[model samples]
Structures are given as structure tokens and as C-alpha cells.
Target: MADGKFMTAAEAVALIRDGDTVGLMGGGGGLMEATHLFEAVQARFLATRAPRNLTVVHALGIGDKKTKGMSCFAHEGLVKRVIGGHWVWSPAMQQLALENRIEAYILPGGVSSQLMREIGAGRPGLISHVGLGTVCDPRHGGGRMNEAAKDDLAEVLTLDGREWLRYKPFPIHVALVRASAADEDGNISFEHEAANLDAPSLALAARNSGGRVIVQVAERLPRGALKAREVRIPSAWVDAIVVDPAQRTSYDIPFDPAFSGELTGTARAQSEAADHARELAAAQEAFGERQAVARRAAVELFNTGKARPVINYGVGVPDAVAKLIAARNEQHRIYQTIEHGTYGGTLMDGVLFGYARNATAMLDAATQFDFYGGGGLDVAFLGFGELDEEGSVNVSRLGGVTVGPGGFIDIAQNARKVVFCGTLAAKGVKLATGDGRLRVLQQGAVRKLVKRVDQITFSGPQGVVRGQQVLYLTERASFRLTPEGVELFEIAPGVDLQRDVLDQMDFMPRLAAEIGVMDAMYFTAALAAH
Candidate 1:
């Protein structure tokens, strides 16, 4: 490459070759903005198949769909495999893989970053205790390599009662990065870009792997002032720079990916615009004719004197639920905690760094588990992939691959009331619940809430032992899991009794005396509009 001319994002990405494993710079907290670079990767991937058998490591998201970035990456099947914390908000990639549209693997975000570091630093693999005893647990196969992916997942092993995962060394051919500012000499500054989880380590990884490192900077500042204090990635690690002055011109740092999406994408922005209308309608419907009955039922469900204010939210409805709880003036009493450095925002490696709000207490994951182990959580609102007759919830294992247990067990074991939220059945299964009835509009060969789950994300035996309350909330009805199984409770107003609720499941439980209806707010405001 000659020195005189600047490279456009499109031109710079032309350097990528097939069979190359690229180490990207963005790791969520806006470390260096990866959009320009990620877009370039997409452009290159879509134009031709030259860069097949590629590997990716960096802040991860699909960009379109319910999750950000899916519109580009997941839509194009560009993600053969993904190794990061999660794209919880963007489940489309996982969906595609589950349906065999593409290949995918879910890994611990921190571990993914570590593995890249190992590869870049010319090391063999990474060792950690994070995924032990969970799906990441090697006993279940440490992790799977996607069909189109080039590298194998690291394996887990135990030495002297201590467990670790072994990821062999791999070569990196390219590194895509985002930076705050840079000088002519190639020194990079992430100045305020602290939100990127592990960008600093990634730069070294690319350089260590003998790969070219490309930086996408928001602005170009004079080279001299980017002293050691400001310099995050030195010029030695950088190969090219794509300066885009039209963007906001500031590194996103490490704001929560959810917040970042709130700022960047269109679907999220549309939802934001509809927030007021949704809220107004939700309030109106909630306060409508059946509202009192619903409220009383909702209250009685949690009227147990043992209930606490601590709140645990699954990834799907977390943003809305947390905001609802907070806006309801309950953040103070309700303990809002996520399984990370901060709470109240979605966490996906490289996507979100931390929530904008102040986390009252920040506990190391282990200590946080201590709270979970003791059954300290008052209620948990989470998403579910499927449930069986035994009332077992599956959120961990999806598709044919695995996304090891993150903090699901800890939360499930400790939370008093665990609420699973999502559409009742997806894909080929069309479902509606009403009048204690289950109706199948388009019969699926499979039911998401099954007689038994393939692998247990949350244990029914454990829930029984703790005598905690559990609820599975869907669009049409709610299933309350008692010791005997799930008892049919509230039904959507227009829903039928036998067709919508009862007939759909494999098992039948004794009806509970009372079950509260979901608030109309989420349906009208969040769901209908979003």
C-alpha cells in the first residue's frame, strides 16, 4: 500500500482476504466506533465470497432486527459464528442459526475477548472459571464452532479441582477498530471511549497476530497532544485510518448497548417516538373495565408477606420492565441489578459498557451469586425459549449450538417470583391462550413450552425446594408454576378458555385460585408499537 492517498472505508476493507480471521476493534462501549469498519466488513462479505471461512472477534451485534446490527450482519448471514457475551436484544442471529439459516455459537463475552488476546499475543488458549458447571462447562462441550466458522471452540478441563477452558492459538489476518482521535503517526486515542469492554487488548491482539489493524476515528486531531495519557492504541498497532467527520464525532465510550442503540438505530428510535403514545394507551387500557380485577390479581400474586423489592429481569423485556419499575418511583425500593459491572441496561460484549444510571451497589459476579443463592431476590422478570410440562424453563441452550448459563441459574435459584415473558410459541407454531384454553392457529410440530426441556436453564426441583413463586407470561395467558406444574391463571380478555390455554400444553395442572393478568402497558405501548 502506498502512503500518499487516504483510504475510504470501502477501499480499505478490500484488503481482507478469504480464510482470514479478523479481530475487530469495537467492543460495545464505543471503544473505537466499528460501524464504519463493520459496514466495510459487510460490504466486502456481500460483494463476493472471497473472505469465506472467516473468524470474528470484537464488540458484537447484528445491527438490525430486534437487536441492533442484525439488519446488516444477521440478515446477510455474514455471522457464521459469534463469540461474545450476548446479543440478547438481537436474538435474530440465534433464531437464524436455530432455524439453520446460518451458523452461530454463543460464548462468554469476556472469554471471547481473552481468546482473541491469546491468539494475538501468540499464546495457546485462555483459562477461566466463568463457564464451569454451566453450558460453557466443558462436560457439555465447551462450545461449538459454527458451520462456516474457521476456528474450534476452546475446551474445558479440570486440574486439581480447579476448572479451565482451553482455546488453542489461532492466527489473525485483520483487525478492525474504532478510536476517538488519532495523529498522522497512527497513535490512537480512545479519549472518552471507556465503554468499550476490551478494545485496548484487541489492538495488541491484531498486531500480535501479524495482522493489519485499521482504526475508524471520529476526528483527526494534531498528533502531538495525543500523549501517552491519551493514547490507547499506539501507531505501531495501527495500519489504516477511516475518518468520518459526519458522525457525532465522539467515541460512545462504554454506554450500555441498549442506550447506544437508543441513540444510533432507527427501529429503536421509532419505539422511542412512540413511547408517549404507548404509555398513554397502556395506562388507559390498564385502568379500563377489567383493570381493577387485573390489579387485585396482580397484587395477590405477590401479596405474600415474604416478597422483597429486589428485581431481576431477563434480557428481553428488561428495558421496559426496568424503566417501568423506575418510572413508577420504585427504583429505590426495588433492587435493580444486572450480572455485570452495572445494572438496569442490556449487556452484550462490545455493545454496551454500563447503564447511564448510578448502580447502588456493584458486586463481583460471585458475590452477586451469593445474593442469588440465598433467595434474596423478590421477583425476577425474564424471557424463555421454551418450557416443558415439568415447568422447566429453557433460556440457556438454543439452536443446535450452546450459549452457556450466564447468570440464569443464580437468578432462578434465588429469585422468589420468576416471570418468563415472550410470545407463547414461535416459528412454525402459532399459539393463542384464553379462558384457560390453548389454541393453535397454525399447528407446529413442536411446542416451545413442552412436556420437558432439552436442557434445564432453571431447575424445577430447585424452585420447589425454595417454595418460590413462578409465573410464565405470554401474550395470551400466564402460567403459574406450582409444585404440581403450571396452573392456568389469567387469560387475555377476548381469549377462549379451552382453545387458547388448556389444549395447547402437554400437561395439565390444578387451576390456581387466582392469577394476575399482565398489565396492558407492555402490550399496547411496548409490544404493539415496538
Candidate 2:
């Protein structure tokens, strides 16, 4: 207890030195972030211009798309390099990566989380097939984001006559993490947080490497109050603790005992207490087009005929598919899983995506990715920002923004059947659907179907090489990928082939002699009946 010291954020941040590699912890919208610590570091840099040119590492995106989390360190000379698993939440950081002002590297979320553990255990590096044929593969680009990213962090080698990637490790000089409570001994507990994330692993990596572990927590308790089993990071691994009494569980949720499993109640009580009806109504109102796409995709899922199919849905438009499944009361028929280790239960939309309403069980994030990376999902419904003539899908970078692939590469590369979902275009696009027909009210200015994508997050050519089934679903038409290219399989009724479909695309698609119309039921009364 005496060895662990309570310190202010400024004092804790002062431990960082210039050119050091600092490890961070957090994810999008789940504000389990060390906000106070980030502010202190930012203030220190602004006031004294010290601790410049440091390398930052994180396994997840840690901001609110504003100046809240990692954006605090977005100034020049503060961060020289960044190695992250995701990048959508932090716009400033992404801009830096886009402009080549800083070196950027994006890796799979599972690999980055697991890499910390390997470093803690004194391993040479991580060896796995998680990023075999994607951009993360050394043969491709080794997870580089821009011209500034040139270091060979990954290497390709054969294992058991099969290709595998080895992601090299680097020394961690400091770790910045968040927790719910800390005892006098500096034992941390995340009893009011959503997920434990990588706090324990990050601490071990920092402490073992003779680095400092700085933790920000909500409250401080006596030594005997926190049980040994409840302590995620022991006093031995923790060096300093910073208390932010006003810390909230997330942006909207200040405190929810249920999130940390500290509260228990009847399932009926939990269900009755939820505002699912309100949330569902709002989602339906705001996601009409997405709901239509989901209805069609649901039919596709139903037709797959796989018994108890295990399905994974990505965020955004594909999320409507999960909502549709729940509305149909078909959750039991399909095993819904996510990369966050949540299996079965209602998948929440928006900022609360990583958590489930009534999760059956929760596994470590890294463990869940291992399942996905090894092709455990029967089907995956993912959103795409761009679809190319070669059938490659891009969701990572678009329109000069660097939104790294969080889990798209792993899920898309390994899923048995992938159904890419999104609108034919974005921004101001309008559509009308009713009575077994669909009509375009107005076309969007930005077309999603392009000649070539800015970046290839899901390689359609690779999927074809592996004999995987790939389908592209839109509000108007659907296409299937083959060895030759994209082939038009179905079109919506009341839509012109040349004006609404062909004219919007950059390249011509192979068409069958008899192009079929999408089942009218998808556009009309079938959705209402469900």
C-alpha cells in the first residue's frame, strides 16, 4: 500500500519523457478513457513544450470525434508516430495521418490487444493468420496508412506450409488507462465501467518494461475494501493513480451499475425496464432506407438455409439487420455475435454498440477476434463506403479521411458468406418503396459504386480465390462477385436499369440473359407482417 502513491494528473503525466512510446486504452463512445490525464499532458506540452515527439499506441479509437479524448494530443511536435487499431472517432489524428504529418499504422483490434500481452510476457512478436491477405499482410503494405508509414512491422512466413504474419513488438515506456475505482494500495477495479478492455495487459506491458503505469479512476477507497479477485491491476503493476470524481461511464451514462455486472435483477424486470420500444421507433424513423436494405438482407439470410446460422453485423446500415431479426423474434434461429465478445442478446445501435442489451456471455475482445479471424461466422453483414468494379469494398478511408479498418478486414476475409450492405449513393439520396415496387425520389450527389476504391479493406479477388461467397446489396440492386468481376443478379421493380443503376456506376457489370427482380415482398407487406 505504501508503494502506490496517489498523484495529480499533472504529476502522473510529468513521468512521460520525450520520444517515449505511450500506450493508451479506450474505444469509440465507450468513455473508459483517461480524460484528465490527456488534458494534463496537453497542458504540459502547451505550457512548457516538453515531452515532444512521442510515439502513441492504442488498440482502439479513443475519442468522441471532437476534442475530447486523443485529440488532446493532436498538436505538432507532441506525437511523432501513432499505432492504433481504429481511427474514426478522432478526426484530428486522422487528419494528421492523412496529411503525412505523423507516421500512422493501423492493425487489427484483436492483434493489437493481444500484442500487449505478448510484450508483457517477453515474446519476440505475434505470429498469426489474422491479416494474411489483407493490407496488413507484409506482402501488401504491412498495415501502413500513408507515405510516412514505412517501417516493416509485420513479416510473412510459412507455418505448417500455410502463410502467417508476424507482427513485431516495440517497447512500451508508459501506459495511460482508466478504471472505476482505486484502493489505497492502487488496486484498480472497473466495477462501474462497460468492459475491462486492455487495462490489465497494458499495465503489465508497461511495468515489465520498466515503464510507468498511470491510471485515472473515479473514486478512492481504503485498502481492505477492494477484494483481491476484484482488482484488475494490482499495486505492483500500478505506479500512480489520478482521481476524477466526475468521471462518467460514458458520454450519456454517468453511472450504471448494471454495465459492470455489479447489479443483478430478474430478466423480465430488466426487459421491462428497457426503452427498446422508444429506441426501435426512433431507429426505424431515422433508418428507413437502411431498414429496407435490412429487410432484403434478412430474406437473404433466411434463404441461406444454414441451421442455427452464426451471423455478425457491422455498425451503421447493417445494424438494421440485427434490429429486423429481433423484430421478427428470430434471434433464437440465428446466433448473433460481435467482435466485442458479445453473443446473443439485443444489439444496441449508435454509441452503445459494443455492449449488448442482455448478453448471454462475454469473452475478451481478443478472444472474440480469434473466433472471427479463424472463420467462425457463418455470415457477416457489413457496411461499405465504396465498392469498386473488381468487387473490392472499402470502409476504412474515404474522401480524404483515414478511418482505419477496425475489424472489417478480419471479419470480411474469414467469413464464409459476406453480404456488403449500403446505399447506392450517400448524401441527399431519397427513395420511395411500397406496394411491391421501389422508386428513386432523388439521387445522391456522391456515388458509392466507383471504378476503383481509394483503399481495399475487403479484397473481393482474394475472396474469389478462396471460393468464398460475396454479395453486394443496395437499396436498388444487388450484385454477386465471381472470378470475372461483379455480376448483376437482381434489380428492384419500378427502377430504370440505365438511369437508376447502370448510369450511377463507374463500370459496367456482367448481366445475366434473364435478370431477376428482387422479391416484391421485400419492398411491401412482408416487413409489416414481421
Candidate 3:
């Protein structure tokens, strides 16, 4: 059962040469990350200063914000360029981009994953409508994050008389992927992983490009130990296998059968209960403004009137909708999904946002995005960093940081109904809610409702043209997107419309002909009743 394909993490990383375009496979919070390989590369570079000026490509953000995942390549000369779906996980990398040290570019997570397959197939590139009007569009900066990023990775072209964005492909000289186990012949299985991200595509891209595909696994099994059906990457495509017995399912979690879809039914329920208890204890003030916004957004799930609607919730306040739905015992009435491909489970928050506890099913990231791009989602609730007078939203490239839109563009552009959840003002906003009324204790200095957004992540005008339902939900008010712009139709109880709602915005929104007061239940502990 022995072969030269098996090696230590350092030996596997040593195969990477200088100036190679290395592809990494993982999602947020180090899910499925080849941690040992990344550590080896970082250590090797620090010790020998080899593999300098490399180009790093990742379909999703992979890090814990402090020091892991992409942050390992934060050194000035370690990486010359970066192309990723999201960037907030590694602040050090973001600083490199901010300082114009590295050529940084962002693309939608779905586009990046699918583009990998296109590269593997030796196709021209990915030509899709996923980012026709967003920042990825060539006309809209072409996904460049800084002046150092000079090349246009995306281009706008008309296909069949319809506009589409073509995300150019690049050769992946080295692909670093992770799985639960690898057989003696190098076949890989992700049986213990929470989600199978773009690992297969990355491996294929590397192999088809005549490059090396290095995979890190927790354990190594004898030949034929893994079933043919369980092997995600065939031995023929993998070049090196690194065994790290200490590999974890996620950064914060050592191991959880529910995350791998091995445990379900009553066991799953108990796991979800434990997670809810932990989150509730950690966020006792969750009943404040953010929860109120989530409460209103949750109502939209039922308003769709579908017997069982398929929905997605973005990170931040939008995640609260899942908790509210669980509180109402309405989990069975809707199918909740995450962009990273888990469905029907208690969605995790913070660094664990991509994985779900007790998920009923886990699809690979690309297949899930296919459903989303085809308008399979009945509704998608997303958090917004800025809302403009034209009803456009800006979640990417905000606050002087280049946090790319992971799946926000793919979900928002394709969902039948999109609800944006956030506070009217962001920094230092304080609110008190009780007895069916909300009081703004202190206003935030930053106004999220602006006349113009710094960048457009979701084009409201394009959404209106597509006839999609778009609504903005906040603690103080709710607005519906219209051809004329944002129309304020609902106001929170005990809030002065002019002082609390209008004054907080950089631009005035058109008032509805018959504005209504938000239901009092949203402001109180009886939110589940509604």
C-alpha cells in the first residue's frame, strides 16, 4: 500500500515553484482548507524565501481573519496577485491589496468555481449573466480592487443579443485541496467534510493544465479502501497526497457528524438546539434592531405563499431570519440554503457561516450555484452595506476594504424575491425595543441610505427590469424598490418618520400613498407568534 505519491506536507508544498499560479480550495472559516499545506508553504517561504511572486486563486474566502488560510500568503513578495470571490477573511491580504502591493481582483464565488471547470475543460472562459451589471462587469471596473490590478479579467459581450460577462480563465499550476481520507492509489474522499467546495474542479484544472494537484487528507487508507462512489478526486488526477492526522472539519470545530451529514433525525435536532442555546447566550441583545429587521424579512418567507419555498440567507443580520423561522417552528415550511451548498439545517453565523449543523443535504458549491443562477431560489435575504437612491445595493468594496461579493451577486440577481436587511445607520447605532415599540437611543454616525453607493453589488434598476421583487428592511422602516426609486411603505411604531427615517438617509425616498406601521410583534419578544 505504499507509493511515492504519499509525502509530508512540506514535501508536497516543495513541488510548488516560484511564479506559479496556485489554486486553493476552501470556503470561509477554513472549511475543507489544506491547512497543513498552507502552513508548509508559509513556513517554507519564510525559511527559504522560495516560491516568491506566486499568483493565488481561490473561489471562496478561506481564513479566520487572524492568521490562517490566505493570510499565510500575506507576505509582500510571497504573492504577486490574488483572484478570489471574497476577501474579508484575511485582513492582512486585504491590507496588501490596499497598499497596492498585490494585484487583487474579485469575482462572484459561483463564477470563480464554474470558471475552474471551464479551465479544466480548456474552454475559452466562463461566459455568464451572473455579473452583468455588478462590479465584475468590464464596464464597471472589471473586478479590479486596486490600481495595481491592471489586467481586465472580466469582459462584457453580447451573446444571442443578451448581455453577459465573460470571466477569463487562467492556468492553475498547482491546486491545493483537502479531503477526509485518501487511498493508497491517491483517490480522495471528503466523507468527513462539511461541504465539498471547488476541490474537484481545482484538481481537474491543475491536472488538465499539466500541473500538480496536491491534496491534504486526515488519514490514508489502503488501496480500494474507499468506495468508487465516495472518491471525489480520482488517483489519476492527483499527484501528491499529504496526510495530516490532526486535520479538522472547520477552524473552530474539531469534528461534528451533523456537519458531514452523517448524523440526522433526533440527533440533528439536539445538535441544533445546542447551537441555538450557544448563540442565544452569546447574543442576548439579539432582540434589538437587527432582529427586528430579520423579523420583517422572515415574514417575506410566508408571504411568498409557496407551499415550500426554497430560500437563502446571507451572512450578518440576514442569518437571524433562520433563527426566527426556527423559533416559529416553521423550518419545515421552507428550505433554507447557504451559498456553500448545505440545505435544511440550522445555519451557522460568523466564521462558520458557510457550514450548517444537521444539514439534510450537501451539494458541491458549483451545482448549488447552478440552481441559484437558474432562479431556483424563491427568495434570498441578504445584508447590505449601502443602499442608494436608485435602489442599488453595495455590499462589496465598502468601508475602505475590498470585501468582494462571495455569492451575493449570484443570489440577488437570480432570486425571484430579494430582501435586503440592515440598519438605517451602521456604526454606533443603538436601539431599545419593548412593548411593541422601538426607541432609537443613539443614532449611528454613518448613513447607509446614501444618494450614491461607492460600488454597485446589486443593480436595482436591472432587478426592476427583470421583474424581481426587491424590498429593503430596516429597524425603522421598510421600503420597496420601484421604477421611480425606493418607496417607503412601512414605518416602525413610535419612530418619527421625518426625524428617524428621513433624516438618517442621505437622500429622500418616495413615500407610499398609504404608509402603514410595522407590526408591533416585531419589536417585542412575541416575534415568533407572528
TM-scores for every candidate against the unseen true structure: 0.62, 0.92, 0.97
lDDT of 3 by residue, 236-337 (tens): 999999899989988877898988988867987688788666555544444677777877888799888799999999988998887777655578898889
Candidate 2, residues 1-530, lDDT tens digits: the string is 22447888888999999999999988767547888898899999999998999999987778888987779888889999988878878889998998999998888777887788888889988888777766687776788888998886789888888888888988899999899899997888877777767777788889988899999999999979998878878888988999999888776788765554444568544662463564445444633556677888887676566888888898887888887777656778988987766687677777676666556665666777778777788899999999988899887778967777877777888888999998998889888875778899898899899998887788878889878889999989999999998999889888898899999898899996788888776777444536
Q: What's the best-to-worst order under lDDT? A: 3, 2, 1
By lDDT, is 1 or 2 better? 2
Q: Where does model 2 exceed 4 Å of error?
A: 1-3, 261-263, 283-287, 303-306, 525-529
In model 3, residue pairs whose N, Cα or C atoms come closer than 3 Å (at least 3 residues apart or on different chains), thus clashing, are none
Best by TM-score: 3
Best by lDDT: 3
Candidate 3 accuracy as TM-score: 0.97
Clashing pairs in 2: none
lDDT of 2 at 151: 89
